[model samples]
Target chain A: MIVDTPLLIITDLVKEFNDGEISTTVLNGLSLSLDRGEFVALLGPSGSGKSTLLSILGTLMRPTSGRFEMLGFNLIGARDVDLTEFRNQHIGFVFQAHNLLPDFTALENVMFPAATRKGRETPVDRRRATELLDKVGLADRRDFPASKLSGGQKQRVAVARALMNSPDLVLADEPTGNLDRESARRVMDLLIDLNGTDGTTFLISTHDETIAGQCRREIRLLDGRLARERH
Target chain B: MTYSFKVALRYLASNRAQTALLIAGVAVGVYIFVFMSALIGGLAVLLLNRTVGNIAHVTIQAPDRDPVSLYGRDSGTLVAILKSVQQRTTLQSAAAFLPAIEAIPNVTSVAGVVAGNGFLTKGEAIAPVIVTGVEPDQVSAIANVAGNLVAGSGDLTIGIALIGSGLAKTMGLQVGQRVSIRSERNIDATLLIGGVFSLGVSSVDDGAIYVHLRTARVLFELPDGVSRLEVKLDDLRLAPEVARRIANTTGLKSIPWTEKNEQLLNGLVAQARSGDVIKGFALVTIVIGVASALLLSTYRRQSEIGIMRAMGATRRFVVGVFMIQGGLIGLAGGLLGAGLGYLSLLPFPLPEATSSTGLPIAIGEGAYGTAILLTFIGAIFAAIWPASAASRVDPVKVIGP
Candidate 1:
C-alpha cells in the first residue's frame, strides 16, 4: 500500500559484511516504516538485523538492495553531497558508545554542529548550547571536557549534541545499554520527555526490555527479517 | 576556514609532543637558510674589498691584457686612442682623468700613476714584488696608501719601498736595509728601505712593493711613458657602467672589479649558492618530519574522524582541519627562529678587523618574508597527507563496533 502519512519508508533492505576470509550477510530483504513524532524501538537477539536497519535508515550506511525515503527525498541513488545536506538538516544520531569528542567541553561539543551549520557560531549558538546542556542536567558540568564526564553524563551530552541542529528525526542505537538501571531509566525518561515536549520523532535499537517497554511501538527482528511489529 | 583552524588548534593543543616535533622540524630549515646565506654574503664582501676594492674602479690595458695577471705579459699602450679622445700638454703617454671625472656628476676623483714588476734584494734575502710607483701627492689621492703605511711613510723616497708585513717577515729585511732593485729597465739600482706598511690584504701588504713614480720610471726605462690610467666614480658599485663608458669613449680594453678576477669572483658566488642549497635541504627535511608527525596523529584519530563525519562534517572540513594545523606549526616555528637568529647576531664579533672572513649574522628583513613563505609551505606539505586520509575515511567503518 502507498503510505501517504509515513515519514520514513524502507522497502527490502539488505546488508553484507566480510569477516576475514568469510563473507556474512547481516540483513535479508527487510522492510520497515516510521511516522511523524512516533517514538519506536527495534529489539532483536545477537546478529539480527535490528542495528543494520537502524544504520541504513539513519543514512550512515548503504543497503545492498533497498529503496528508502525520508521526508520525500530518495536516499537509494542520491549523491554524497545531497545525502550530507539531508543528514545535516534532518537526522540526529546517538551511538551506543556515547562517542563524544574528547577534546571539547560538553557545551562546546554541543555547539560545534550548530556553528558548522550556521557557517559561524554567533551568540545564539552559545545560548542554545548552554540551554541544551542545562536540559541534559549538565549545566554545572558544561565546561568539563568529554573525557571527564561520567558514562551517564557522556550519553546525556551526546543527546544534547544530537539535538543541536534541532533535527526532526533522532536515531539512537542502544544509548542506555552502557548505563546502570537508574541511569538507563533517567536517559529513557529524557527521550520520552523530548518526544512529548518537542514532538520529535525517534527510532532506538536496544536489548533493554525495560526501555523498549516504555516506547509506543515495538518492532522485533529475526533471521534478518521483520518477524513481528506491534503498536 | 576559521572553523577548520579552530579544530586544528584544538588538536595541536591536545597533542603537545607532536606539535613540538613539527615546530622543531620547520625551525631547522629556517636556521639553515639564514646562516648559509650570511656566510656567502660575508665571504663575498671580504674577497671583493681585499682584492679589487683598493684598485682603480676601471683599468684599461691592451687587447691581450689581463688585470689579475698584470705581470705575465709586456703591457699594452692604450694611450694612442685615449689621446684622440682627450688632449694633454706634455708628451707623457698618460694624463690625470681626475679633473674631468670630478666635473661629471656621477664621476668622483681619478688619478694616473705607474706600475711595473721587479725583484728586491737585501744581502741574501730576495723577494719579487709588483712595484706601484706613486707620487707622494698621488699616493694620497688615489687610495689611502700613506695612512695605511705601517712604520714610516714620509721618508719613502727614490730607492725605499713600503713593503707588506708578510713579505717583510719572509725577506728577513728590516727598515734602513740597503736593498738592490733589479728590473729590465734603465734606472735599476740598489736603494734603502725607508718604510713599511700594512693594508690588511695579504696580496697588497705581502706581495707588493711601492716607490715614487719618478724612481720607477728611471728603474724601468720608461722615461716619459705611463703604463695605465686609474679612474674612480661616485659609487664603487657603478664600476661596470663606468667601465662600459670608458670602453665606449676611449675604445680600449676596460676591466671592472667584478670582471677582473673572474675565477676568484666565482668563488664568492659559489659560497652564496651553497647557502641556498643548505636552505633547500632544510625545507625538504621539514617536509619529511612534518609529514610523519601529522600522519601518525591522523591515524591515531581514526575513530574520532569517523565520529566527525558521522556528525555531518563535510569531507572538505575534515581535510582542512589537519592542513590548518600544519600551517600553524610552520608559522609559529618560522617566527621563533627569526627572532632567535636576530637576537643571536647582536654580539656578533669577528676576528678580522674589517670582516673579510664571513658576514656577521644579522637577520635580513627580506629573509623573514622568505622564511615565512617557506615555513608555511613546509608545514602544509607535512599535513596534506593526513588531512586527505582523514577525509577518505568511511564513517560506517569508523563508528562500527
Candidate 2:
C-alpha cells in the first residue's frame, strides 16, 4: 500500500552486464523508494550489486529494465542530455576516492559543482563556497590545492562540493572506503550531520557495518538481489 | 572566463612540457614561412628590376607599312617607290612627338634617338658598328645610360663621339683619339672619341657609338628623322596602358617591355608558383604536427574529461574546452613565430651580399599577418577531431576505471 507520495520510486529495477557471449545479472528485480529527507545505507558484500544500483541511480549507467522516477519525473527512459542535466541539477556524488579534481584548490573544488551548473563563478558563489568550507571546518585550508590536502580533508572537501549545488540527493559510494579509522569516523559524522541539518536524501553504499549502523535505515543486498531492510 | 576556458588553461598550465613543445613546433614552422616568402619575393623583385632598369618601359616607332592611295593603283605604285627610295623605317621629325608623350600622366620621361649601322676605321683596320644619335641629357633621363657609364662625360658635341669600350679597344683608340666613321649611304665623318663607356651587354659594348643628334642626321643624310622613341613611366607596371594611350594619341606603334621580355616573365611566374607550392607544403606539415600533438593531449587528459562530463559538462562544452586549448596554443605559437621570424631577418641588411650570404630578404607586415591568421585557422582545424574524441569520453567507464 502507498503510505505517502515518495520523492523517488523504483519498480522492479533490473541491471545486467555482458562480457562477449556471456551475460551476468548485477541487479535482479531490485526495487526501493526514498522520501525527500531519508538517510539510507545500501549494505552488501562483494558482488552484491550495491554499487551497480547506485550507478544506475546516479544516472551514470543505464538499467536493463525498470521504471525509476524522482519527484514525479521519469528517469528510466530519459535522454542522455536530460539525464546529465538532471544529475547536475538534482544529484551530487561523493566517490570513495574523494575525486577532488587534483588541479583545483579546496575552495575551487567545493564550488566546482555550482560553477559547472552556472558556467561561471560569482561573488555569491565564493561566499557560499567559503561558508561551506567553514561549515566543514576546513576554512583555513580552502586555498590549498586538493593534491596537497590530507585524505580526511579531501573527503571533507568532496562532501562540501556535493552540497554546493544544493542537490536534492547526495549519493556517497563508499565515501570513506580509502580513509583511516579516524578519517572514516569524521567523514561518517560529516555525512550524518549534513543529512540531519539539510533535510536532503542520501543513498550511501557501504559494506562497513559501523558506517551503516549510523544511518537511519539499512538495506542489504544478497547475490544481486535485495535480501532485507532494517530501520 | 567560462568554466571550459578556465579548465583549458589549467590543463595547459599543468602540462608545461607538452605546451612548450607545441609552441616551439609552430614557431619554427612560422619562421620558415616568413623567411621563404621574403627571400623568394626579394630575389624576384631584384631580378625584375635588374632586367628592366636601363630598358625602356615602352618604345614608339613608325608603322612598318606605308599608307596606300585609295583612288588609283598608279598612285599607290608611286608612293611605294618613294617609300622604298626614302627608307621609310624612320620616323620623320620624331622630336615633335616627345612633348605630346611627356604630357601623358605617369610618363616620367621621353627621349628620341636616330640609329643606323656604320663602320669605324683606324689606320688599316676597320670594324662594323651601330651608331646612335642622342640628346645626352634627355636620353640619360629616360634610359639611365649615364649610371652605367664606365668613363668620361655623357655630353655629345658636333665633332665628338662616345664609343663603347670594346670598340675603342678594338680600334686602338682612347679618349681624344680621332676616328673615321662611314654610314651605309656612303657618307663619312671624322670625329674625335670624347668618351668610352661600357653598357655591360657585349653586343652594345663591342659595336655601339653615340654622337650628337645633328652630326648623326648629317652623317645619315636624313636632315630630321629618328629611328625610335623610348618612354619611361613612374611605374613600370603601367607600361601597357601608357603604350596604348601613346599609340592612340600619336598614330605610332608602341611596344611595352613585357612584350619584349615575354620569356623572362614566364620564367618568373613559374618560379613564384613553385614558391607557393613549397609554402603550401610547409603549412600542411605544421597543421599535421599540431593535429598529432593535440590528439596525444586528448588521450592524456581523458580522465579529466570524464570527470568534467560526469560533472555535467555537455559534449559541446567539452569540445569547446579543447578547441580553446588548441586556439591558444596556435595563437601563442603564431605570435612567437612572427617575433622569431622578424628577429631572424634583423642580422642581414638589404643590398649587401656574397655567394655564401646570398641576398638579404624583406619581410612585409602583410606576410606576417597572413602567416599568423593561416596558422591560427590550421591549428583550430587540426584540433577538431581530437576535441571530438575528447568529448566522446565515457564518464562511467573512465571515472570508475
lDDT of each: 0.75, 0.82
Q: What is the C-alpha RMSD of each candidate to the true structure, in Å?
A: 6.8, 5.0
Local accuracy of candidate 2 as per-residue lDDT tens digits, B180-262? 99998789999998888876556677898888888888888878768889888887878889999999999999999989889
Off by over 4 Å in 2: A1-5, B57-143, B154-256, B351-357
Native contacts retained per candidate? 0.32, 0.41
In order of appearance, the predictions have TM-scores of 0.80, 0.82
List the pairs of residues colliding in candidate 1.
Answer: B42-B359, B150-B197, B164-B205, B187-B218
DockQ of each: 0.41, 0.44
Most lDDT-accurate candidate: 2
Give model 1's DockQ, 2 decimals: 0.41
**Per-candidate total of colliding backbone pairs:** 4, 0
Docking class of 1: acceptable
- Per-residue CA lDDT of candidate 1, range B182-275, in tens? 8745346776777777766787777677778888777766677566666666556688888887666655566776676778767866776777
